[model samples]
Target: MNFGREAMMTSDIECDVRSLGDSGKQRAIFAHFDSLSVGQSLVLVNNRPIEHLRDAFDAEYAGSYSWQELEPRPRSWRVRIGKTASDALPRVVGHTSSGDLDRRSAVWSLPIQRRHDLDVTIVTLAPGTSTTPRPGPAVDTLVHVLAGTGTVTTELRDLDLDPGTLLWLPRHTPRSYTAGPDGLRYLRVRPHQQSPVPDSDGPW
Candidate 1:
């Protein structure tokens, strides 16, 4: 498998939350954790007991992740959280909204378990942001809005989007998206096994 330069070069990420406020700390840690790839791990350094985070992590990732308390310090605690190398059985994967972390014009995240047959992504677009028009992938796509609103422009027409809106885009259709004033967060799913678009010249 192609582990990619990212996962190969950054095997361990350190998240220091000692200086952040109570509420900000968990978000910071989780953001770092969410960015990790298989075989990569996060080293969390904090000022308080982080045993509670273990329960939170267990509740989110359970069998697909590992946690180990490192050597204790006088005032700091450290724990190594790793995404396990083993594959998980078919099961429910939990995820909340991207919320404040998806602050960029556009951002996307995959659920913990990435399956070979499907490419599932949570996409967030900041207010007034838009995705450049491009020919859709070779595989069919299903997009479901989870929050906010947007307009999806396809070859045929512009479709308005709202929370709970679900759209189907057939393979090879040209499409783009523009976020509403409130911004947009949606789920995009495609069949990973389908052949990709032939051209590789477009922006990523």
Candidate 2:
């Protein structure tokens, strides 16, 4: 058994509120750990005066917060806790409007739980708008069309995707997307460490 690989699996990204002053100002902290072991827990040392850590993963809730054990697989295998926010988190809100991409494109990132891996985001593209071309880091990605229609063009080929379609692209492969007349919506799933970077080689 290769415990070496398992032992080296730790959260590559972490965000927390670090401090708060008597003046009612708050500070945030973001840390990246090299590796983590199974059964070992990561603690959020928060100095905020709030009774509960605002963004810490809580174990007694559902929907608003969630935590998963990520090891030996890209997907989180265990759900130790769940979401618990009375109101939606920042990432849960829709940040884009119709015909918004041509002016100012947007990406709404959801709360994700992964260790040394990538996660997924549901992206909504405005009608007649397209994404900036770019290659992702060294990781595979799968785009699952949730609603609407679109065309995905890559350096290798072009694919017309609609609801129920799933498109796969490898890392660093140049790619772009154009929304249909009705607009496009899809879930982009990839490794946590390697996200798709915007490429300028193609038109947006």
Candidate 3:
């Protein structure tokens, strides 16, 4: 919910509409939303219900965007509005280069993209840190090291991770990770797992 100015080609932006009038607010919101390219999003912060804006988007955009409620507070509402490509088209997600990621955080994860049945993520682990071992779900998981170094420990053995190392873990495999001295940055791709509560829809 801490939104600040972003640089060029960033994945997200923010719009705070508390000080604008009704018409001005709508204009500001749509202006930012329209400026976004596919796969980019705008985080809207407002003091009132955005049901009208949601309705307007439904009328004008049809199925070209996604609306998700991020965080709800007693005095403010935070909503994430993401632009998506049409079903028949393809769009670039974002770069996964180590230099492109934020390095200040010791651990972080970025969801690259989510398709009908697939999910992709970029994860970073600080030096010497470790991830808890967990049993994989029914779908297979693919891990590709983008930068730094690490070790992928599976039930069978421990595999070293280098910049180009690609590891595949079958379904139901137990796995964990240990970052090397230089830290670890990797891409993880797997099948999308359905959540009990729908994530894309909010009360609006």
lDDT of 1: 0.70
Give per-residue CA lDDT, model 1, range 1-204, as digits (tens).
222122222577888888988888878987787777888888777776765777776655668888766735646677778888443435655464755423433245443322246666777777888888898777788988988888998888999999999899888889888888888888778766434445321221
Candidate with top TM-score is 3
Runs off by more than 4 Å, candidate 3? 1-88, 98-115, 195-204
Tens digits of per-residue lDDT for model 2, 158-193: 899899998888777788888888778777777566
Q: Under the 3 Å rule for N, CA and C atoms, how many clashes does model 2 have?
A: 10
In Å, residue 113's CA in model 2 sits off its true spot by: 5.1
Question: What digit string (tens of lDDT, one per residue) describes model 3 on residues 1-204?
Answer: 442332212677888998888778877987888788889988887887665778777645557898877656646777888888543244455677644222423233333222346666677777887777777666688888888887988888999998999988888788888888888888777777676644221100
After superposing candidate 2 on the true structure, give the runs of residues whose Cα lies further than 4 Å from its correct spot. 1-54, 59-108, 112-116, 194-204
**Local distance difference test, each candidate:** 0.70, 0.50, 0.70
TM-score of 3: 0.50
lDDT accuracy of residue 3 in candidate 2: 27
Candidate 3, poorest ten consecutive residues by summed lDDT: 106-115
Candidate 1: C-alpha RMSD to true structure equals 13.4
Count the clashes in each prediction.
Answer: 0, 10, 0
